[model samples]
Target: MKRSTTLISVTLIFASIFSAGSRGGDALGKDSAGSENPMRRFLIEDGDPNLSAIIKHIDNMYRSKSSTSRLKLIVTKPRNTRTLTMKTWTKGEEKVLVIIEAPPREKGTATLKIEKNLWNYLPRIDRTIRIPPSMMLASWMGSDFTNDDLVHEASFHKDYESSLVGPSEDPNGWLIELKAKPDIVGLWKKLEVIVSEDGRIPLVSRYYDRKGRLARTLYYSDVKDFDGHIIPSKLVLIPEDKKGHKTELIYEDIDFDVPVPDRTFSLSNLERKK
Candidate 1:
């Protein structure tokens, strides 16, 4: 089946912290780190040097300096299943475009994010809707995904206060938790990420509601090499309140730090028919 984009911003903002809590990928191996590394640049608490490095790598999964990818989104609810393929283009923290490529109904459907704002274009409606800041974290225009690709992109280092909550020997990975800091905007009150010391892949991530209830759980596996870097190509998210409801994102292709055009991030381009 065809895949989707981080564009799951057309798109999934993710699948961000509040993305992994964005569809995800494991970006680096234990030996390396990149400049756009989120954890390294914005670490709130410095406890374990090794833990901090690992945390940075996790954010890199979504906050890649600039990236392009073919993503496949499979949303499975107890009632039905919907699948879509999206092509996404992103440039650092500035811009992103996600276009639906299949299921003719959704083809040409897209979302654009520039700076911190979001817009959605519906081919059928022939309209461009500016996703309000208050609603950006709420839902996708056409799919069940709640994280906007833009919201997902800006999340991670930008939205939360991070700390190594504590080390868990039972889980065999450092437990990293994120809470919304003052002025930071997001839907989850808390998030927990588990990264295995044995590998570069994050084993699991849990997103919590404002009241501290477990809202959802994300599982990452199928670790594979994309280019020279090692990352997980598959991410599965299950919502706690919604029984049998899940979203799965698979990375069919991804290249980080590619060239991008700034104009593509504009509202004018978003509404222009392609």
Candidate 2:
């Protein structure tokens, strides 16, 4: 009788241990599921109170001093034509001004301010016309890039919700894909931004049109150290529909945090600056 009692007690203890182990395993599996979901992680991480580093990095990139560049714009469809020389200056995210020096017939300077303000200082007409937001999607100086691309320099963190799409590899380095929130205001309906895991520089971005088609592919190449941060010296914009045509922007000179006068960003400056 004593032996049977002892055996029964041992069996009950073993069963309890087995039950506890099973419950613990189930809990761990649930935790794993939450971590693996990219959307869930993005929402939680984006809401982190400490986002100063990301914000500062974006601000420094957009608010820098003038950057001179030579842009070669190719239009493939009607004919394989190209525009040779161009120079650009950016005064923060609010203003971007470009001057085209070559192809005398089409040569002129255009200044684009944020939102609804824009002007083209046509040496030919010697007049300025205010551009509206509806025309933002129009080709920029006959290039593949739209006017909206120039003025919409808002930081991704501020304008869109970001999520890690899991570990992936790209030409640049280890990458994590980030999808923009549906309600975010921007030209692209969705964006797949490839960011280097080590450097945190955005490498390649695939932009989808409003209908969810892959409309454009933007590759950030020739990364150079500007000041203390790494910036892409060249950005190549290629439209999927326009085969054989690409816009390559080569940054010749760049400076950051320089004092830009208030007048530089004004609409009057756009019209007056020859």
Candidate 3:
């Protein structure tokens, strides 16, 4: 397949969806009211006090004031395998910029997401194309993930109602169930997440389609301590219906709560060479 075709088909996933906000520690973070961020009024809290805390913890895990990282994406198939290296910059939940670094042909290609808008820069043609809302669910870069996954348009706390599913022995963690709220539009109707018992790190998440069928599974591993924060450095995503197909995202380096200039997320910077 042509490099352009592959790049166009590839969709963003791990970085925006799972990367930013958690502060690793013993106590759960607080909400705006200066209280614990968990759903205290929910019945699930009565059954497992940690359930709500875990949900809130994981929801904010990858979030930070600002962050920067270099990642390696490996997409594997039955007949072919390809790799790409990229550097990413993010500011809070609003701005994100991803620039390809390796594979000479795609070296300068970039994607920018600011608030609700997303755009891609193709260096080869010196053109910028805006991604419409209609393509939010489209697969990115020929991968299993979607465009929405790239920009993180959905929030677990706001979009899904969660419940405690007890313990999981296989991964040795707590199982949490999340069902989509009827009002929100998303590809996954439900999700099952296994969170590590110790630090509440997400170990595995199973995505279920609208029909309640298992669609894909995301496995998080290789825990690393970045500064004071503990996070999974590697993530592997596999679709249930596809054989010998999977995408592995490995974090090469990351810095959280770092300084990021405003222009870094601008349209002009999208065309700037790395």
Clashes of each: 23, 0, 15
Q: Candidate 3: where are CA atoms >4 Å away?
A: 1-15, 18-49, 139-141
Query: 151-243 in candidate 1: lDDT tens per residue?
Result: 555444557778777666746767878887778555678889887654256889888877889877888878766554467778887877777
The root-mean-square deviation over C-alpha atoms between each candidate and the true structure, in angstroms, is 6.4, 22.9, 5.0
- Candidates sorted by TM-score, best first: 3, 1, 2
Q: Evaluate model 1: give its lDDT.
A: 0.63
lDDT of 3: 0.70
Superpose all Cα atoms of candidate 3 onto the true structure and report the RMSD in Å to 1 decimal.
5.0
Task: Give the poorly placed runs of model 1, Cα more than 4 Å off.
Answer: 1-49, 137-172, 178-185, 271-273
Candidate 3 residue lDDT tens string, 1-274? 2343333333234335434344322244323122233433331344453665567666666566777888898989899998999888877666777788988988889877777677788899999888766566565445666555554546677789998787889898778899999988877899998877542578999999889999899999998866555678898989888889898889888887789998998888887753
lDDT of 2: 0.48
Model 2, 6: alpha-carbon shift in Å? Answer: 88
Number of the predicted model whose lDDT against the real structure is largest: 3
